[model samples]
Target: MRPPPLRRLLAALSAALATGLAVPALRPSPAATVQVLAAARDLPSGTILGPRDVRPLALPPDAVPAGALRENAVGRTLAGPMRRGEPLTDARLLTGGLLRGYGAGTVATPIRIADAGVARLLRPGDRIDVLATPSPGAPFSRTVVSSAPVVAVPRLRSDQGALIVLATDRTQAAALAAAGSSLSVTISGAPAGPPQNDGPR
Candidate 1:
């Protein structure tokens, strides 16, 4: 026997509601959580990170990964050593290979000078200003000099610093390394103005 019209309509409406609700259930749910690696200690800016420097951040059980995952993620040091529990971001992650040139036109070069003593004062990752003074007897005694960021610090007893010259060309690198002992580097805040020769004579 067929049910009454109203009963049939009610039954159909109930089935439609169930079907609508079931669609959501059948759809795949997002991943509940993800693990992200972060720094475990204060990593200096420009410091290259290895497995040792990273720690993982696990999201809650219902959270999904928000961004692309880097399987072989490499982070570059953007600032000095970071404190423990610091979350890692692209700013601190090195996306490219080691010595991945950063800043403008940086390259490793040998800085030669007469006094190793002066070189000893500099350290890797230290910012400096390069000064040039023309030979005492050169005509047109204009001092041609430029400042390059130090990429590598000279080791104790080493006569030269393996510097990653910044904003410099091959010719400038050679000139800076070959100039007389007058070539002096004064550790300075990120370079200001053009290279200076007004330092104490």
Candidate 2:
């Protein structure tokens, strides 16, 4: 019969080798990644997305941004500029902000405001009214837009003035655009009435 101490030594060695072999199997694997939409090239602000403009990318799980869904993307206009290979997030595309309730037939018209300070105070979802002045000091000033939803307040350089976007009807959009730089903005509280969203798109 084998000696008790010798048998114990062999059993210990057996367990040590078994544990060593099992270590590799117990080691966790790397986290799985996913394919997400990203800009193919340097996409400028206001660029309408096309199939060629964007492509799916394989990225690490941690790198995927919130709201970067392929189904939500595609065929949307960019509100802000994006560099090449930039991931497409919800904020990167134009639909959220003031376009919240009104879904269709709304035109995003970028208008320059007379007061940069007031424009800076304006945030998305705030309702505003726009006044137009015909000439520098003319008395022909009139209210061109009343209670309009403020969409995006774009980032501006130090030398640049404040520019904001509003969603309005086709005729209202045309009139606001045709008014030129005369648009002065005033931040009203919540809209006076429920959105006059035209029937059925």
Candidate 3:
């Protein structure tokens, strides 16, 4: 037998009401997010960040990495390549903070590379041997510091030779200083050994 029209209407209304109530319970509330600076576009290693190089991104609190920067990323050099939207962190920039993890007695030493073209290829964290060539016709170059890790590669100027900062101990720093303008570098596989304190070898 067919239900009465009024009875059927009431049953449909009850079912609709139940669904409306359940929908709210099944849906979740929006999560809160925190804003942090991120790469605006694909950036190569050694790029000096500028205003347009970074943008603000909102991420879940737990998603944000330790040492992520909320601001002040501009003018900092990138330690490595970053994809668009990657969060900026202290570890990704070339700064004084980078030296802290290198250990005690470690110093950031700035040296001029004899070949600007060769220096241009270096990025942070690269292990290289600092060499000193005696002259234009020198048969062999001497290694001033073996397997020093490059920490920073500053932007080059037309009037200046390429300059790169290396993380080295006091002894290596002195040798690099003595090498001066004769400094050249060759990329090496891994660090050659623990920090050498016996002087340049």
Candidate 4:
């Protein structure tokens, strides 16, 4: 059948439009993610975490760190400085039995270093010798605990001396606790000497 050229052109155009409409548009599916606790802001070492300090973050399953904390981190002290969005891990908190990985019978002991400047230089994993002077006029100081590993250095307050947590046995912990405010520390690559049998009263 002979048709007008314009009418034939319009019929072809309508067929082309109908074919295009029949095909569905392609779209990619959303990726899967997992939730983990993360720091909400820049936090320094020794910060006791609270609800406002942490936030839940979604990340790819593979991107999640091993031992990442999914539960609340409240009441846990940070072992090191963490930037915003950093994931919380068990190793980062001073949890109960925080020294378990160090070895059996090791306890986390908190001690004050008389010299805040000296204590500020210490970090976790540093070996130190805790020394105590009997009096301000004392000529010499003695090592109370030698070769103790620093587990955490928490800055609690500016008005007080620096507080450091050390991994020590019961005996060393007792000596440190006894030494009280007269304590200072010396960082060492090796043991300074045998730990003194006598500690300041």
Candidate 2, position 143, lDDT: 69
Candidate 1, residues 88-169: lDDT per residue as tens digits? 6554433333235553444344444445676767765556666655556754333334345555542424344222223344
- What RMSD, rounded to one decimal, does every model reach? 13.8, 9.0, 10.5, 8.6
Q: Which residue pairs in candidate 3 collide?
A: none
Where does candidate 2 have its weakest 10-residue lDDT segment? 192-201
User: What tens digits encode model 2's per-residue C-alpha lDDT throughout 1-201?
Assistant: 767998999999999999999999999997798988999999766677888889888889888888885654667877766788888888766664556677577767667776677777888778887777766566656767777887788764333446777777776767776777656876767544533322111
Clashes of each: 16, 0, 0, 0
Against the true structure, what is each candidate's TM-score? Answer: 0.35, 0.53, 0.48, 0.48
Candidate 3 wrong stretches, greater than 4 Å? 1-94, 135-138, 191-193, 197-201
Better of 2 and 3 by TM-score: 2
Model 4 misplacement above 4 A:
1-93, 135-138, 191-201
- lDDT of all predictions, in order shown? 0.52, 0.73, 0.79, 0.78
Please give, for residues 130-156, the per-residue lDDT of candidate 3 as tens digits.
Answer: 788764666777778777888778665
Return the lDDT, model 2, position 32.
90
Candidate 1: segments with Cα more than 4 A from true spot: 1-98, 103-105, 138-144, 156-167, 177-182, 191-201
The TM-score of candidate 2 is 0.53
Answer with 1 or 2, whichever has the higher lDDT. 2
Better of 3 and 4 by lDDT: 3
